[model samples]
Target: MKKIVSLYSVAILLIIGSCSTNPFTGKKTLALVSNDQLFPMAFQQYGQFLTENKVVVGTAEAKRVEKVGMKIKAAAERWLTANGQAAVLQGYQWEYKLVDNKEVNAWCMPGGKIVFYTGILPITNDEATMAAVMGHEVAHALASHGAQRMSAGMLQQAGAVAVSVGTQNQSAEKQQMWMQAFGLGSQFGVMLPFSRDHESEADMIGLTLMAVAGYDPKNAVIVWERMSAKGGGQAPPEFMSTHPSNETRIAKITSQIPAAKAEAAKFGVVFK
Candidate 1:
């Protein structure tokens, strides 16, 4: 059974999706989960999330969220068209929502579904900073990180199932051990860290997008600094989780600022 499943997974991965090169980082990417298959599910999930959550409408922050979303969308389209990647974003139907929550969280899902919790608005204090945030979130969708995550999850699940099948007939103690291993391995190895990498990649892409959209890319550095400062009162050590440390993320953004500015020059940005 395990062998059959493994063979099936390999075959499916090989045949279903064509691998593509990432424009931002030039990395090879496997996209087994097509946008056509993933977008509808993401749209449904976004709707469900909004219905379940406290969606704040007709507010300043809500309007800001929409404004930032539009700017980022324009920036994304400009970047794609400039790079001849307009086809990659051809089917995106972008929507951004502001949900009244205090979790200091924001996300963009596949097919351009995005939501910003009101709590994080304070961290993104101004339009420029907010553009940084929106740019980062939108970049995740443009880069297809969600689809990559789903593909990773499928492979992780297949691995867990194989291990379980291999040990199901063993002693009770062995079965318990395998179960724990499966849980830990699936999460830490496949799910958790992958999010952080995608986050960083999105950061790079977002910085450029915001810069091209006429917001200073330096705002990306400021946004991360603000985000880091907010968590200073009580936050996990950056290495303990999936997110990059504020310091590290800020430094990387700073280093990339020159490139972002240079790229924006093609869009008629004047250096101060």
Candidate 2:
């Protein structure tokens, strides 16, 4: 009992000690690895990914990707500066690439390295919807969601360690079984929910960002609607997935459109 209590107490302290505030969200989040440590790694990985993939350059769609990505980055800068938080992006080396793949996916690495898969372009369909998607990816970087996820993973490992230590007195078979159960419980119950929260946060931030970047926040809802309509097959239930369901995402983004417009209004940006 005492060992378990001590282990949990240490885990709590470690989590608290490793937190840093995300300027975009104005929320304290895990920061076990600082940008100082994470960016170089992310940049290198991005370079390797580009080298291994077919990077579509010197094309109209590629140019569109670059143009919209830069605008979204600038919008983030404007918002950060307006809020007196510009320094939060001091270390970001923003790079955008459109990769020729059919994965229907996009991501923003730490320090603002972004990639858009060509497969998703069909779903994006137009420049406005593209900005909505770009904004979401950029928001992931600005919010340090990757770092938060890594930090959460570290805490999950620490909890596993605690469970292991606390159960050391049990038989080996029982111990292994408990560890397996703990792994599943933590992944499904804790980690998946954490990832879904990040996704939702990115969705909200992205809506505001696209609106401030002169894209109608309403297009964000339209983008998701298209994403849903384009039969990507079924996804696991939200409770078992790293992302909220398409329906859930569309609903959440729709509800936040008014708030996003209000935020854009602060920057003297409005939609018709």
Candidate 3:
């Protein structure tokens, strides 16, 4: 009991001490891993990934990716400045690369390292649609989702340790059963919801970002519609999935468009 109490005390202190405010949402978020620690690792891994993959350059598609990525970056700067949160990006070193791959995906690592796979070009064909995707990916980094994920993983591990220690005196079979239950409960209840919330938050922030970058926020809906069509409705249920279902994402984006456009309008970007 004392061991479990100590474990819980440590976890609580870590959670309380390792939090940072999200600039976009003005929410306190977990940040057990700082950008100072996370960025160097992410940059190194990004460099390795680039060297291991075929990086497309000097092509129209590649140029487009760079172009749209810069626009998104600029939009982030503008929003952060306007909100008096520019210091949030002080340590960022932004780089955008287009990689030749068949997987329809794009991602932005911590500290603004971004990659676009050629396969996703079909879905993000035009500048506006591309902006939509870029904004979403960039928002993930801007909101520090990666750091939050790592922090959450740490807490999950701590919880597992607590469970193990608490059950050390139990029969082996009962211990195994308890551990299994904790695994399922933590994953489905805590981790999945945490990830889905990040996705939804990114969608909201990304919509505003694209709009601020002079892209129609409504096109964000179209981009996801294409994504849904591409996936052919072959996704796990929302509760079990790391990302929200396509239908759920679309509905949320649609509902958020008005607010996004209003946000853009503040920066003299108006959409018809």
**Top-lDDT candidate index:** 3
Local error of candidate 2 at residue 186 (angstroms): 0.9
Residue-level lDDT of model 1, residues 1-272, one tens digit each, is 46546755775766356676676677877676888999999889888998899899998888988998898899788878888877888678899899888888889989998888888988887889889989999988888998887777776676666777777778989978987977887576657778778888999999888888889988888887787788874766654567777877888899999988898898887456
Residue-wise C-alpha lDDT for candidate 2, range 1-272, written one tens digit per residue: 46767988988888889888878778888888788888999999999998899999999889999999999998899999999998888799998899999998999999999999999999887889999999999999999998889888888888888888888999999889878998999999999999999999999999989988999989888888888887575777789999999999988998999999999999999777
Over 42-111, each residue of candidate 3 has an lDDT whose tens digit, in order, gives: 9999999998999999999999999999999999999999899999987899998999999999999999
Off by over 4 Å in 1: 1-18
Ranking by lDDT: 3, 2, 1
Q: Comparing 2 and 3 by lDDT, which wins?
A: 3
Q: Clash totals for all models, in order?
A: 0, 0, 0
How good is model 2 by TM-score? 0.97
Instruction: Give me the displacement of residue 185 in model 1, in angstroms.
Output: 3.8
For model 1 the TM-score comes to 0.88
